[model samples]
Target: MGNSSSLHLQQEDVQAIQDETGFTPQQIERLYSRFSSLDKAGKSHLTREDFLRIPELAINPLGDRIVHAFFYESKNGEEDKVDFKDFVRVLAHFRPIKKNQEKNKLNTRMEKLHFAFRMYDIDGDDKISKEELLAVLTMMVGQNICPEQLLSIAERTIIEADTDRDNLISFEEFAKVLERTDVEQKMSIRFLS
Candidate 1:
């Protein structure tokens, strides 16, 4: 009887996650299996080191920033860790927005842009300063471009994106700059059905 109740609870949890994240039961189960595999210490939460251990993320130019995004909401000196729910929520941001999805849904273009914006807004100031832009650019192309050329490119990008001339790129300015971009396509990830 206890085992049956436990199984029922697990089903409830999966259903809740499906409703919240727009992921099917199979996908959630598959992700749960992957997450469990990644939880090396069996702590039920993943630390920075655990995520960095993934070779693909380790090689990505924005790897650190992407990992940081998972822990961005931590406060009060809390240890940086991502549990199953948080993991699912963050991955949901990368799910392709369905044609029938509401504009207010989490996978919408605005949410995806917001996620990308946060990647560059390292300081959480709600604006991407020139220094922040340069830092991200350096991380992305530091090996390929000289420092001076990278600075020039960052400057040019800011000038073109800073519609208000405030010397910073606000979310509105960032969205405007990407107004014609296929963000829905570029930011999406294909999840197994």
Candidate 2:
């Protein structure tokens, strides 16, 4: 039905990639010489071996397209040598745009994190404390609750939501954690109220 199959990231895999991209995982993972594959770890990263693996193929976009074309041909009992140089050119074209998009994505992530800290700094303290955590957790839990539940809830809220090691939960960390669990249309109303 289709010329080629596409590899999609699972929800957990997507989260891992996003988190890794946010932190140092992407670079660190590569050092182990393990590859990041579309399906898992089967396909290795681009190195001399992978580059040379394709005999006649170039490592650019045209090459990439040609490879796919060749693959389709092969699957149907046909074979052709793809130009490696042209494939390299295709990859070169994609490189710049990919880098730009990644940068934009990183910037957007930072902005959201910055905004969360701003909103939670109700007293302009620049640091979220136990009291602040309690106040918000109380609201999310509702107005009428017991003291014991409140204490446990308050503690859990701060412990689970706090991401950075500063003993305070920054807005960005909280937002990221919440994002993993739930999505609200008006996050501001919930946070502000």
Best by lDDT: 1
In model 2, the worst 10-residue window by lDDT is 184-193
Backbone clashes in each candidate structure, one number apiece? 0, 16
TM-score of each: 0.89, 0.33
Clashes of 2: 16
- Candidate 2 per-residue lDDT, tens place, 67-113, comes to 34323222223233222222222222212222334433323434434
Off by over 4 Å in 2: 1-119, 139-143, 181-193
Candidate 1: minimum summed lDDT over ten consecutive residues — where? 1-10
- The reply for model 1, stretches above 4 Å from the true place, is 1-9, 73-79, 101-104
Which tens-of-lDDT digit does each residue in 31-132 have in candidate 1?
Answer: 877888899898878999999998989999999999998887433244588888788888888887777764435677888999999999999999999999
lDDT of each: 0.83, 0.41
